[model samples]
Target: MRVRLSPAALLTIFGNCVKIKSVNSIFDFFSWLAMAILLITAIPQIVLNYKRGSTEGASWLTFGMLFFGMTVLAIRSWFVTTDIIILLNYNLGAVIVLIANMQFVYYRIKK
Candidate 1:
């Protein structure tokens, strides 16, 4: 038995599928891009602290609050699902913040 399909129907299905995939691809790209940018954003602070040999504007309260929040968020992401990108980025950010926090403590004591 042979069945005939209309060209318009096929075109419509193909077009919708392509549209959905494109949107998904765009979203995935931006999500991971933001993750990468956030992961690296902490480096400058560390560098500045190194160059200055002290932590000036970087407040302990700010660092503590940010790290705590990030840690909580990462934990939540872990419990909810295994999103490696989210887990890695948030944890890395927390670690970087910890490094900065330690530099502050050390430099303050030295000064």
Candidate 2:
């Protein structure tokens, strides 16, 4: 016996093989991993700032630029995915950079 398949039928078959939710979940997992890694990268700078009791040699301009960039990325991520990981990654990243900027100001004034 011979069988003929329509485009809709092929789509249905392929669709069953690959699910949108599963693909999104995979991306979400990676997003969470990336978020964790990126967040960790900021910690060393924060700790160094705290331990040293100042942010000398660190340019406030750098952190200021980072804050603005992160804030914009966070907003864009919210609109793009609204996924918790994406939201936290960008928003928390922005907050961290903002704190770094504050550290610069606080320490500069302290000196």
Candidate 3:
């Protein structure tokens, strides 16, 4: 016996596929924009730390926690295919935290 698929069934499947793609596209765009914002916000702090050669009032505990947290977040994002935004933000944040922490530690030791 041969089986036939109805037009409504075919249309429903296609419609669902389009919806999923649309949602994914929207998520990707928003995630990309969020990552850009994170980068922009972090760059100034990173630059200031480099230029000043100090972490001054910034707490070591704070930066250390942030560095570790971001590192873990980045790794988690890597495991989830849909988390590119998180991956970018956390990885870049980790780098910035590491740089700042290093500067802080160096100045503290120097003094």
RMSD of each: 5.5, 5.4, 4.0
Name the regions of candidate 2 deviating beyond 4 angstroms: 1-34
Q: Model 1, clash count?
A: 0
Off by over 4 Å in 3: 1-3, 57-73, 82-111
Q: What is the lDDT of candidate 2?
A: 0.81
Clashing pairs in 3: none
**Tens-digit lDDT string for candidate 1 (1-111):** 998779999999899999999997897687568556655666787898899888887778877787787778677777875868667766776777778778878998999
lDDT tens per residue, model 2, 12-104? 988976897789789778867866775786678888999999987677777788788888988898788856856877898888888888888
Question: lDDT tens string, model 3, 4-72?
Answer: 889999999999999999998897687568557656755676677667877665667876887787778
Q: Deviation in angstroms for 77 in model 1?
A: 2.1
Q: Against the hidden reference, what TM-scores do the models get?
A: 0.60, 0.63, 0.62
Ranking by TM-score: 2, 3, 1
Q: Could you give me the TM-score of model 2 versus the true structure?
A: 0.63
RMSD of candidate 2 to true structure, Å: 5.4
Off by over 4 Å in 1: 1-41
Q: Please give the lDDT score for candidate 3.
A: 0.74
